[model samples]
Target: MTDAEQQYESSKPLFEKSYPSNGAAEPAGESEPQAADTQQPQFQTDEAFASAQLTLRALVSSKEAGVIIGKQGKNVADLREATGVKAGVSKPVPGVHDRVLSVTGTLEGVAKAYSMAAQTLIDSPPPSASSLSSGTTSIRLLISHNQMGTIIGRQGLKIKSIQDECSVRMVASKEMLPNSTERIVEVQGAAESIRLAVWEIGKCLVEDWQRATGTILYNPQPKEFGSSSSGGGGGGGGYSGPRVRTGNPADFDSPDGADQTQNIAIPADMVGCIIGRGGAKIQEIRRVSGARISIAKQPHDESGERMFTIRGTADENERALFMLYEQLEHEKVRRQMEDQEQDE
Candidate 1:
């Protein structure tokens, strides 16, 4: 937790609330010492509310993430808004079964997140496993570094929000690997809940990623080497300075700078949805943003892990953010209509 979060926790309301029997209101209240419940409040304020983290887990097959996300996190977002917590996934922990996802949040939030995961699981149960002999499920995800920033959010506020709303716990997804300074991202949870969590992740990422290509992006494009034009300015020894070529726009962005890419933990299968029909939509994203975009390969292994890369200038990056957000907003309205239809 950062300083602000720590401060928020330190100063969070801690009182607890109690209730009194209404039938005894007059006899118990008039000229008598107030009952504990009545003297306090109906809810806990300082003593009742705790600011500690709660751990959660989920499970599901790698293929079912898309169904849970619901078009750019509409379902999960709704869940968070309803529950007052931010639901998110943590990275996979090594030396454990391949099928597990981990998460974290406040106590009540974690409970609520678990409930949401259960709801998703009940909505679509995961496949059973014979190895563990447990009908329950679990799953893990390996995410890209760039994507991690989005999951973590601005100064960790986004993640905290997810923790508070989803009841799911989300810690830094990092693990040490051999021969490299980079760490792996791990997200473990109940099999079915993990499925939904990742699905939500994938949908959320679609809102952040943007495609850029060699198109009408209103920025100056890098030029290929050209024949030199004759220059006549030579004071004494006829010495002409070497031509300086401009650098790539990517040069301006620091590897440690704010991440413009989106984070989605959905199964690799859902990537195509973001790509759109016949790659037309992704192409459009690229055209509009002028950022290079690449999705992670499927069947995630150390070598073939699923991921996406977006490279572009500041304006182009902003453009990508806008396009993805726009697309998600449009999809959200469409889903709401569909939900209304099903309800009717």
Candidate 2:
């Protein structure tokens, strides 16, 4: 046998043994059924094992963690129910602003849950300015390796055009994402500029997909694209297509009725960042915003993250959200700088 084939054969047993399985038990008060006359003979082998358990970890920013949890914890609940996996977010590591999301279950369950969580993190929008701030806004987009070339184009022409037209700085990561077949594209500029750059990059990706598959991936209807009659359908009656919804809609408006409640998921490790050294920061926010904030007990199924419920008027809830987001953004920047330093 060739060296590569022999090597693979030698390691086969080791690989199989590494995944220890749960022992099987015979049915109670039951005897083994006898084989039929035409039944094929069964062979005894070590492959006879029960289901194997697996665990995986994913790193996410506090903002992304909130997206994974969803409104009223619906997203995570659905994930568990659909995949039969137990998933939890870890409190922020003592010094890091990022949280570790943990998924554990049978092999199949873990794989499904991990894929769902990874996609959610990849698709989640980066943190944005809650108030009017002239400071540059930085956003990260995860793009698959195959699509990266489309965005970059020959000699980086496409990306250069985007930067020149949108007035935004764009950088693609040199390395592939950890345990993923994607890379990170970082865009920095004013909110509007960033949006323009994203749109252009998306257009490139769509064109590439169409050419490769000979199928139009994004075919907007006449009403959706816009009608010349209504001044290019600039939010006029000419465009009557469905709106593409993004982010948690519940976050946009306050709860109906007198009492308004907003639920926010804070990474366990960074909970301290929000609470401050001695609850000073949280107390200050409550006093100034008049929002009653309380941390809810971690759900049995959720780990590595804590939930906070803020109760008050619409204004108060908005104020609390602003403060929380601002603090998380600061932490994110600090951690990012530290990582860069370590890399250097």
Candidate 3:
């Protein structure tokens, strides 16, 4: 046998010793292996020889994780007992807001556990929205990175207000889009509740924009006067109005310098979403952000993901990156819904 094959054969007993047997029978005249059998190895019996273990991973917002785990992990513990699976949820990834759920067990156990978890997500009723007559539904909102603070409000007051007023379960992801600064906000509840929440969110965005632009009427400012001044004779002395700021606005671009470039990797299939219909989306992003963006012809990662290089001032590059990620997130949700529909 080849060296690799021989090595694998040599490790077979060790592998069997590490894991529990699949309800296998003990050899005749041999006592069942003790739970603390440090050297004894067990093998699958003929009845369950085909049994195999598998792991499934899923992403869920931290808020949803709380529901899945229930009070003091009761929910997850119950699910494990009912489905004969080992389930665990990891803390949110370093930069992402979503936690990772892992279900490991026999194929059937994994499927059962996953289905149960998914149903739990779908069936969990929103707080105080039971009075709404509309059917339940779920939707995801893509919030711009810069606007997230406004939506969340100081000390989470705004989000709390939306939840209490609209009666929908809202979860904002901790992780930004794969390579972008935007995050996903998931809302679930009766259709009417969702609509109200969305409307409220839109209002918040508008208010933030107005505040940023100093367009809100609450903050009045004196209008700038032309060359003709009330003080007469071009002396223009008594003009106490706000000075007319000239030149370009502050470049808030990258701190690494305007010439600094960034490269991001995106899955091959998602490239089309970022490109949009006939490259329209990519072109729009470039125009709006003043960033030169290009995609590589070859796959840049082992996962068959492609590389995109963005060149511009820090701000421009960030804008382009956000736009691309926003589009990608939309595409991801669309595809997931489609798959779920197909399965149904």
Candidate 4:
């Protein structure tokens, strides 16, 4: 983890240090916790100097805890730093709702922090009422190592490009450690917008796929169509098309597909730079922009796992491409730093 990452981790369990006796319990509306799920609230004094108290839930199993904390606490830690709240887990209130998280601080501070955390999540694209549950609409994306440089370009310019161009929330995977395959990129937004971004990502993948597989057949699968869970089935407008096939992923056979896809190519490998170790940096581009992304396979290696594609709507495709450029910008700076270290 980088120094910044370390600082972020030190804070994930923000209220862990100040063990409080009691916290004012607010009646939870309807979002009750299941057998396993934890929520934390942090309380703090109004001043910059005063310490804050945070409370969390033990109901969150270790496996789930890891996600709450995020890769190396990147996501969780980020939640604290961004909102200036100290977060930690707490015991369940005996009679009240088990998920009640206690956060204490300056009434305003606590409220602000709580509000930020809530809105951040609320802003997140929930599962489709029809097919996707409020539980599973969100998806994860990982970039490739070689492609990292292409996304993050010089001095972090490319990623910014994507963000500016599209209406999606894309961020680096905080939990990612150095040289780990699990670099995380979170892409979140409205379902339609997110889907659009995913489609755009797929377009890029088509290019890379063509370069690698010598064909433009690569594509990304949509998140979900009009709602139908394990039981229901029907077709709806805006959600209708072909049944998505994951393994046999296919793209538009129509010749215009290529002309329709591609947005500025990020102008350089700057997009690649942000891709990070195995495309972590650039994965957000695919996610937030709602693009189905894929990198291209190499020729000589002969393994078959390269082409990167992002799938979603038209705006999403454009935004993902723009983000891809931004990733390249981030990657360039990273490489220069590596080169400097090597020279030293």
Candidate 5:
């Protein structure tokens, strides 16, 4: 871990003041050493862990996305310039209503960015805003399945405690993201309440990641999509997979004959990015997901959306869908940035 990360680990108290203590009552005089997983990782001091380099992700509705992105992406650009954090919103994925927003930087920077984003959400009008009159908004965080149990606690007590303490309502989705080991957790309330809820949730994520990976920083998977290089720019690393086969989706059906199929409607304009140059992107998706994918040569209807079909086991289909969604979102962010630059 970098020095900043080390400092952030040490300074956890600042951001995680409300995290519940893990003090269990042991049998008197029979204090045998406990397993690391059973214990909560403790931090030394305050302020610095808030400086550790980390990334926090959330799923937001497209309307809320526009508010955070602002006209010509000015709001997001301003967010980065003012807070020293990297903020990115994935491009709109066909069939998916929510876009993934990533904020990467010191703990303090990420918190500030979220606070500003939350305020923006509150100030907006109906439908997009959760409740303007009540000064309330909601943020849906994309959390991995494994870490979720920690946040939910045994029989939902943990999640309830967090909501009661922060004065926010929190819920974890029952449905998982396609090809993903993650699900969304929605927290709603006033901006400050949301901040505290997020802080508590973020603390749990960091601790769980540390226990599993032995590191202070948490790097979520599928965090990179549609970049020129698969894994560059602190994206963790590169991707290497089996040779890709590209052709009719029918050619890759299951040998066991247990095949399930699903179709997604993709906007005509966004299909090219998912297919990538020379079909490299689609091939990669096929290889990684082991799903048979084919896009209609023509638009499905007057709506001008193409029918993208996937054939595989239930697992493969979901994975393929998730990967495809990330590709579109990545492309969307890229185009938005480009447009912003052109206006400048």
Candidate 6:
């Protein structure tokens, strides 16, 4: 194992330690604490409450994301206005049909925004979802895979209780997001039930955040090039497995300075997504980041990995690389889903 992996293993137990309860009620006469059942889980200390902030991230399909963003970002603006929270959608990653919707604020604002987003989705599902049963919608939130056990509780009691109380169906995906330690927990039901469930789930996350986010998950080894024939033959639809090195977004981002160039090995199959339809995606990346990027015409040696070259100032390169990383991640997830569907 690499140094990082070893360190992660050594520190693994820290995240496994029990956390404080989810705002259990204090003595009745001592003080009337905030309604933890109806609102966010209460922080133990007033100081903690004054300084606390939470950010919730959820995965939405392309169409659903469009609705959340609305035309010219009016929908997101409306959400921010309504919930008194900072609401935003991630930029479209190439070849990735799913986008992340991020809401930041106090726990109360997040819950409100989460509900508003859910309600909006229920009222305005994509046309493709019209065939589904009416009055039901699904929202997928990104939860740390390591914390799944906490959410599940011992013998599955916690999740069961949440489902029973909120009248929602919750399923946490066994598969983590590509190159990351987070997975999707899909909650499906009516808007109100979903809203309640979201609040409960958010509480679980808040309680576990200290240990969960600090826990490091080792990156799974990438498969050898051409190992999967699904999207082989240079079609760029093949699954090359996860080659992303770092999951941290801040790694590439640096203050502008000397010009630099870097080469990343791209699986032969993923080049199509990076390039987009008729090169529009790549061009967009260049336009936005002011970085010059070039793709190798042939595989790097016998590994079948194409050399993706980027050149620019530090900031520009970082920006371009960041976009590429996001694109690759989303594409990986999409392809995995496709393969799973095909297998089924």
Per-prediction count of colliding residue pairs? 70, 8, 6, 101, 4, 0
Candidate 6 segments exceeding 4 Å error: 1-52, 130-132, 214-344
Tens digits of per-residue lDDT for model 5, 1-344: 43322211111122343645443211211221122455746544446456666667888878888898888888888888878987877556445566668887777678678878888887763274543336877788877665666776654556666766677766566556644456677776777777777766766666566422211111233433323222221121222111122234664464554677777766666778779899999999899878999888997677566778888876676578767765754554455445434443
Candidate 6 vs. true structure, TM-score: 0.51
Q: Kindly list the per-residue Cα lDDT of model 2 for residues 15-80, writing each as its tens digit.
A: 121222332211211121121334332322212111344333345566766777776667777778
User: Number of the top candidate by lDDT?
Assistant: 6
Model 1 Cα lDDT, one tens digit per residue, 193-254: 33334434443333333211111111011132123421212110111111222234444554
By lDDT, rank the candidates, best first. 6, 5, 3, 2, 1, 4
What TM-score, over all chains together, does every model reach? 0.25, 0.29, 0.39, 0.23, 0.54, 0.51
After superposition on all CA atoms, what RMSD does each candidate show versus the true structure? 20.5, 26.6, 26.6, 22.9, 12.3, 15.0
Candidate 6, RMSD to the unseen true structure: 15.0
How do these models rank on TM-score, best leading? 5, 6, 3, 2, 1, 4
Residue runs of model 3 more than 4 Å from their true location after superposition: 1-145, 148-257, 300-303
Local distance difference test, candidate 6: 0.62
Worst 10 residues of 1 by lDDT: 212-221
**How close to the true structure is residue 301 of candidate 6, measured as C-alpha lDDT?**
68
Among all windows of ten consecutive residues in candidate 2, which has the lowest summed lDDT? 6-15
**Model 6 per-residue lDDT at 319:** 73
TM-score of 1: 0.25
- Model 6 / residue 44 / CA error / Å: 5.1
The prediction achieving the highest TM-score against the true structure is 5
TM-score of 3: 0.39
